[model samples]
Target chain A: MTGSSVLFDAPGPKARRNSLITSIVGGALIVAGVVWMAMTLAAPRESGGITLPGMFDESRWDIFADPELWGFIWNGVIGTLRAAAVAAVFALILGVVFSLLRSSRLKWVRYPTAVVIEFFRGMPVLLMMLFILLVFSTGSYWAVVSALAVYNGALIGEALRAGLAALPRGQREAGLSLGMRELQTKLLIEFPQAFRQMLPIIVAQLVVLLKDTSLGYIVGYPELLRATMNNLSSYYGNRYLFPLFVVTFLIYLTMNLLLSWLARSLARRRNSGGGGRGRRNAGGDADVSPDQAILVAEASAAARRSTST
Target chain B: MDVVIDNLPLYLQGFGVTLLLLAVGGVGALVIGVLIATMRIAPVASLRWFATVYTEIIRNTPLTLVFIFCAFVLPYLGADIPYLVSAFIALGVYTSPFVAEALRSGINGVPVGQAEAARSIGLGFGQSVSLVIFPQAFRMTIPPLINVFIALTKNTSVAGGFFVAELFATGRTLANANGSAVIPILLGVAFFYLLITVPLGLFAGRLEAKWAVAR
Candidate 1:
């Protein structure tokens, strides 16, 4: 579908005037809201008092320069990165294994694989993390990592399964026709192509993982969020809570945006590299069919379609 | 199972809060999402730009931050909001962009001919969109909307971090109280979440299958 609609006719003079009035009113309302918020924030109130100008106070940001506070933040960052890295790697492995099992020749494997994937996908990461931490006496680090792995692993697996399903039926058939075993056909032919297609989504899921790591704060994990909160409460009490939250928000936004940028670039690279295994929508090989490829293809296509948009 | 039964009252109260948050947040998201989606596809360039910027900013940030904003920023702005209200606002605002994206795609999925036909019959833009385009788009969006609701339900657990006494918070409190029975407590908690999510998932699957045929 096209990005923008072109079905409606151009506005006539009266319609243009109406549009102008609507735009002006809408703009005014938004500007008014912003002004109101600024006024409220800057208002000298006993409770919830945070003046707009206070955000720029040199003392408010001094924590950034303090070695003690900065050290804690650095530790938090390192801790977050460590967990994310471990989770991403293991989740990728889990994704690949689940996808493989889901696509296996054995009928028994697919049912259990699907059950596990769906269960994790539907389960909240916070619930899983807290459950693991409490049940196994695992610390926050392992709790965050394991929960992320299970949830995102299922998601990535689905993406890969879709990518595999998207391939022409002939891929597996060609491998078999060439005297290759099912395992060899899958490993050499389908897996590589599927991995390429799934790369962008995998990167996007990593960004999701990073965002979820913030949930580690609920368990008292010293991640970026929890660290920032601890520093805020101790250093300034609740005086600068909003400002610190704003700072934390910006950091998370920047990181997530960077990940999305990376994913987009990967998608662009895949699209522009021209006709190879990476080429999606390769026509003319429509004849070959695997037993359950249609379902897998639809599932993967749905997953990818949601992510790409 | 025995743990769940013993803590039945606590679990029930927590789940009630969970449903309250979800119900309120779900409706709020749907309304705001449709408005944003409308702005997104509207004829006004400024509206479209605003919608795009809002969606991008909201989608890129963590939901936890959104909760923090509501819990802290709203109070900073002089509103003494309760934790449940704060959680509801956060969930609603956070989920709206995703719902908008889904609805925007649904809008796009509608045939251009549908709009053209509405115009041909002298329907104004408002009537055409509200009557013709939206009806079909809403049908197309139901499954994704359900998915968003499911996500929002799971997300309400984050409210526990903000001290909202939801199911997760309830579980945490109970587990901490009965340290030796933490496993049973968590199992009960997970089961409660599943009680909400699993049926919704099955319903979504059913709707999806039915719609795939209708398509």
Candidate 2:
């Protein structure tokens, strides 16, 4: 509160408390409405001549238990994971490569990489998928991987660029003063710092990409969604909702948990190792003094005052 | 490639269906998205729980599964919703969670002090949100919202599986009818999609840049 935030002007303690209450109240009302509606409303019924009990099935937990479904799902999951993982690797490589290119003294390599990154970053993931699908058809696994790699690779470029920008100008000057090559400055000093800062955001984007593998089903690839469709058509058409809800919860929960854990571990290591600027900032003085915090809040509030004509 | 030109009229029909589905589903999802966003951010404990469950349940599932469930199920209870409406319902619901997340994040981006100032100006609780917070939120949220919209537009191809006859279906139909030309036909479909998504992406970028400069 002592310093100005990027957004809103600051407020006094009472004002902050009041707004927190309104946020709480507004959120509460929404939850209440959803519950009232869901409980009062009936589960949607199937339109066919027959009705099935609308509940999640456990017996077909064996469907997952089945080697065939398991193989397919496993393969699908592996393919998805491998694609995302490989793409992530490629993205990292590409991001680092592009950052070095831009940071280099020569303009030749820098501008092309910049343009390529911007074009792909500006387009949607689906467009990338479609463009790749055109070459690969339904059977080409490499095509999907390539498409994901290139597009995500582009995004990593931007993340790296931003991360580099976050570094203080003094660091770059010090590296140059020490007679380091531009590449040495970037790789030895700049990148390690930027990568640490950008890791959380990059991870979040990767999770989105992981979820996006399901989009492959549109091109007739037999991924998890395809498996779900196969099961629904063969066994329990009328009970699609419950089964869908369960399967989605299970699969996504496990994957997201794993990803989150990896992210946490990475963050933890960086913090413990005293690897970057964050470590310097992590000293005991990092704690905000309440009085100064209040003053900052007051100052922040003062900015909110609009001077009317 | 030859198939596309020969069947130009039919492919145009398919493009029309694709556009219609996106428009209807996009609008429907926007309503559902806004509602769920409010729910997720609600103040009540129990109420917030419901929104959490909804987002958790919906966001995790594959969009394709939801679409299939809508297509294959719900017929046993004496209801026969049209394939288009069914597709819309599933896609709309699937996209809503994303939109909700985008919006909630955007709204959260607005500084809390703004809310305080609005209240000090004598705006009531809801008034502060609807008038002060949301305008800023909408401005911030446009970029992500555009990204979601582009994804949703592409996802409509999923309904092609249920035989809804959208652009993808038309491409597939053309592929089937004029064998070995799937590549060009899909390229045709992709062309239509790019024609739509690119402009929208640029528009959203403009909106974001404008808001960024404003703030």
Candidate 3:
């Protein structure tokens, strides 16, 4: 839906005047906030500020000129991508497995799978990582990868389950009428359809998983945030902390924005490509994030459950 | 079992801190979120731009980096906040964008006819939104808002790494001290986290079912 336009009318003459006044005021406030932040950053350390030589001072930024520092950061970038790639693969595989199990006809299979999914989803990723490291004595990298995989797998499984539930009953019925067993229908027909419908959401979840790999810092994995904030800052001294943070922040923002744009574009294509299919999946819009999609899915699923019971 | 039994007080203390963070952070996020959501819909062009930019930046950034900024950069910039206070700010600011997105979608879910009706009655924009739209919007929002808080509950763990002695931090400390009981210690931590998240999930489900607005 086109946002906000539905909430109010097009501005009349008097309303236009007031809108202009508020716009000016808002612009001034934003400028004032930025200027104040700059002044604070330029203040002395004796006043509890960061500017020993000033935040904008050339000496503070001169560290970037060093090629060795760039090499260090490149390693960090690779490290973060490596862990995310491996974790994403495992998480997708585990997600498919969990979703299949969750859709099983047997109560025994479904019940325990539900409990396991809930358990993984409920626990904090960092706690799980630390637990894996301490209990199993896996290296820090494995701990981070495994925890992310399991947690995101549970979420992805739920998203897929939602997609499965949203599918038209005819798809499944037709498969069964063709003499296909439940498992075969789900695998060959239903699951592929669900996967296609949920592709945007799965990609959105991967973006989240990528952002979460920064938690590898706590587990002592050499991810981007740790490489910059922990390792680089220590190596370059505390004077460069703000500069390092700015660089790290930009890198992450760029990567995640690109991924989010990809998800939205995929949603847009899906919406435009298959007209009737798009309308059937509730909240499967270009703007919905993975979390929101899952929430919508769960809400509908809950409604379905209550009505059936 | 004995390890967990003996360290029950430590576990309780950590659980309390986690709950406190959740409550404080949840309130902070809701307040900021509502304000941002309002700005996004406001007639002022600059306000809408500001809100959109803020939401995008926060949504794309990791919670860990947000924590680092709150815990380190704020102090470096002369904001003498404590670790716990910083943790609260980090969680609130990091989660606010999601809250705003949910609220905006809720507002979108309100029927366009309602707004037209409000306008026909000579109601101004603010009056239409507050009196007519928001009340309806909030009904559609409760389930998703609850889901956001459930996420906030798990996010509190990131604060532990930033020096707040929350549940995950306590788990780390206890695990280091009693390495042999690592399994039980981590399990205890997981149990406490589940105590918060599971109930919230169930409550959200119930609310969704009960408040299934057929629009």
Candidate 4:
């Protein structure tokens, strides 16, 4: 059966009629819902509705006409990108370091590495950011950047460790036979393969890191969400809140969707390209959510555990 | 350490609110998520389109924006929901899509032959899905679903940002007051969160192993 029609057989004439009727009813309900929301927005403030300058009122959206507003938005975009970029770089470096230590042959090194990764993964990024800000007295930007780096670095480390574990044992054996030490084998042979295999997952995690930059808003960082919602909204007054929200929402949506699309396409390419043995275990599915990648990583980790024991 | 001990009551109160948010939001996400997953696989084209659009829009937007909508925009639109209730709605609506995706993947994991067999036995879509498919799909979904909830445990902290006195907000207040004890205050908050998340994670691993054997 086709994937779409797996849940049902081909519709008979009677079934076709039933489906059409349901479609029409569903369509009507959606339209009615939209209309109801519009009416509510247009209603008076005394009735516990929108205050004067209702949503549809042209003046409510007039703030977009100011070139200065665009400048503020541009600064917010730069702030978000700057934090995300710094975090992503530090996260990758930290991920590599953590993964390397985690895969160490020494129990002392490996166990502590595992503990640290789990601790970071288990903690909330916002909590970590707040802790850094208050305890260390780092500026808000460093708090956001450092927290995102440490948290995501832990996740990426696990994913990379999974990637390393999923590699064919022969690859490592080959390296050793060619006169490489354990560290050399991992650094020169295993790490690059795991990095390439887990690239899409890393990219997906970066999207998560980017979304979390909005948490910077909570800590008083002037990121896009804070800039638009707090700065622009206060400057323009409550009447313009909805318009500012719409613009901010669109900007976040566009950036995230683009990154997500990149992640999916990367997974697809890796799947089709027949890169290496790890490909079979490396989130072969084209639509890889960050959690799904982690799930795959967890499964591989589990597999590694079972084999070792 | 003394700071945390002295503020123990405050920590417990914040912990309680955090748990309350997680419980309410988890249930809300599950209910809305299952409905959306059902729509995504339904026979009707429009329903499928609507579910897909809803999931994408919600998934791409940051949790902060969702909180902003619940905290600020809803009131402006005449929906004067309470802040706690608004936090519940924000977490639910924001998280439901991830839940839906997890369920969808679980459904995909089910063997195609099973669906074909159910259809050959003359089961309707609802009968086949609810009776045969969902039961099996949910079994496969438990581990991922737990991961989702673990993520939700951390997400409850976002409510703190929006005026709910959850653990993170409590930590902030405590840290501000006891500036010298910021470390202990924040660590106390982190301990409470680990109390929820770490166990869920271990449970997920255990269940995944058990299910793998069953499969």
Q: Using TM-score as the measure, which candidate wins? A: 3
Q: What C-alpha lDDT does candidate 2 achieve relative to the native structure? A: 0.62
Better of 1 and 4 by TM-score: 4
A best-first ranking of the candidates according to their TM-score comes to 3, 4, 1, 2
Better of 2 and 4 by TM-score: 4
TM-scores for all predictions = 0.87, 0.71, 0.91, 0.89
lDDT of 4 at B126: 91
lDDT of 2 by residue, A188-250 (tens): 888887777667556655665566666666655555655555644355443344454356547
Tell me the TM-score of model 2.
0.71
Clashes of each: 1, 24, 0, 0
lDDT of 1 at A101: 91
* Local lDDT at B158 for model 4: 92
- Report the number of the highest-DockQ candidate: 3
Give the alpha carbon lDDT tens digit for every residue of A151-249 in model 4: 989888987986887576767888999999988999999998888778887887888889999999999999999899999899888888998999999
Predicted complex 4: CAPRI docking category: acceptable
**Two-chain DockQ for each candidate model:** 0.38, 0.16, 0.46, 0.43
- lDDT of candidate 3 over B1-215, digit per residue (tens): 89999999999999999999999998999999989988997778999999999988988898899999999977876688999999999988988888888777676666677888888889887998899888877876887788788788889999999999989999999999997888988999999999988998888778755654544
Native interface contact recovery, all models: 0.33, 0.10, 0.45, 0.41
Q: What is the lDDT of residue A70 in candidate 1?
A: 61
